[model samples]
Target: MSVLSDLLDADWARLCLLSGGGLRPRLWRHVLSPRFAPVLLIRTAQCLHAANWPRLAKLPALVNFVLFGIEVPPRMHIGPGLVLMHTQGTVLGAATIGANVTLYHQVTLGAKDIDFTYTMSMRPIVEDGVVIGSGAKVLGGVTLGQGCVVGANSVVLNDVPVNYVAVGIPAKNLPPEAERSHEPTIDQSITM
Candidate 1:
């Protein structure tokens, strides 16, 4: 899907809230809104980068840095439907991020330290539906598995198993539950 469509699809919950649970929102109106401005800048940068205009891509990213204090480098590969909640002082220098990822303000997804020579390989890969809490720092080349929930201010340096909740200064996964009630199940043979 196009970035706009993917973004809107991912941000359905926010759209519903913005429209007071009305029908789906119009593209230009919502994406351009201040609340979604950070995401917009990221998208713009990505588009510019994809279009082989790295120099031009820096413009929106620069604006994003100045206006939002958010630093999501154009090199970062992010899936659609990002949710940047309370997204001030957020830094996304990760290698890859999956769909429907939600990030709170002050979250850092980057190298372990000030590695000037570090490449994208040094950054973390956050998978789909992961919720990173405020002030969380997920560093290193670890893969944060899909559907994981990271607690606030946690520092993660290792791979977190899928669907587990990791918390603390150096994050550690909690034991898995017997069954997850929050997640939906699917069966192709079943009918609604």
Candidate 2:
């Protein structure tokens, strides 16, 4: 799909996410909201960058960084339905972020080391349906599995399995919900 279509899809997805919380969201209102400005600018920057206009792309990117405190590299590949819950201090240096990913404030996804050279192998690859909590740092070349949740203030170094929850300082995966079944209750009574 074209960049405009992707942007529209992302806006709609964000609207749905907001409406899920019981607040009716109007498309026009959402489009004009300051909260959505970063997404718009970032998408615009991406569009410009994809068109081989790096110099022009930097304009929107610079605005986003200055105003929202969100640093998104123009070269970063973000799929549709991307939602930045709160953009303050959020830096995205991922190789590729899949569709329907939500990232909260103060989240950082980048290289583990101080490599100024933006190499794909040095960044994280976030899959679809992932929700990274606020203050989370996912560094290095690890892949965050689809449908996984990374807890707030956690640092993920290793790969998290699909549909698993990763929490704590050095994040560790919790067993998948399917494997966490409750034991059956047994009735031990003598019937007459």
Candidate 3:
């Protein structure tokens, strides 16, 4: 599919429409109506909150709550078409996230503190089309490049390159070119 089509997919667009309350709605409308440049920021925050984090599989029901008081730390930078599937209790620290990223529930993109008063010098940078799975904790100054997929419940502390899939506690990359053949495909072969 085309980039624009993917970006403006019906599911994502619908999520954007239902993000915030009075001010949030106004702001979101203003951003989306004109196709604003910084619309990605709103999308990122809204998706992260709406994804029903901390709850592995109950996202769609949570989207109806009035998300007026949620805190999306302003230190983070988010991109467009970001999908937060089951995004509850997700905390994003001072980091940069690229376009079309997907984050699952209970994901914490936080920083390690060097001292009681000082946060670590580095933070995470998530590139385009990256998928961060449920209950994953991506800490420190790791840079995940384009198309990287992080598996569920993984804890990431190292850098990952494009098209690689990382899993486990330290989040190591799968074997080279493993993602191409091992991509997750949910089958409905046992249809009702």
Mind giving the per-residue lDDT tens digits that candidate 1 earns over 19-75? 476656556667566657777788878888887888998999999999889987776
Q: Which stretches of candidate 1 lie over 4 Å from their true place?
A: 1-9, 12-23, 179-192
lDDT of 2 by residue, 64-139 (tens): 9999999999888888878888899999999999988888999999999986879999999999999999999999
When sorted by lDDT, best at the front, the candidate numbers are 2, 1, 3
Task: Estimate the TM-score for candidate 2.
Answer: 0.87
Report the number of the highest-TM-score candidate.
Answer: 2
Q: Which numbered prediction scores highest in lDDT against the true structure?
A: 2
Output the lDDT of residue 34, model 3: 24
Backbone clash pairs for candidate 1 read none
Each candidate's number of clashing pairs is 0, 0, 9
In terms of lDDT, which candidate is stronger, 1 or 3?
Answer: 1
- Sequence-dependent TM-score of model 1: 0.82
In the range 1-192, model 3's lDDT, one tens digit per residue, is 243334445335534554533223233344334232223334433445445442422232223222321124533456666656554466656368887777776787767554233253577888988889988888888888899898999998998888888899988888447435664456643452
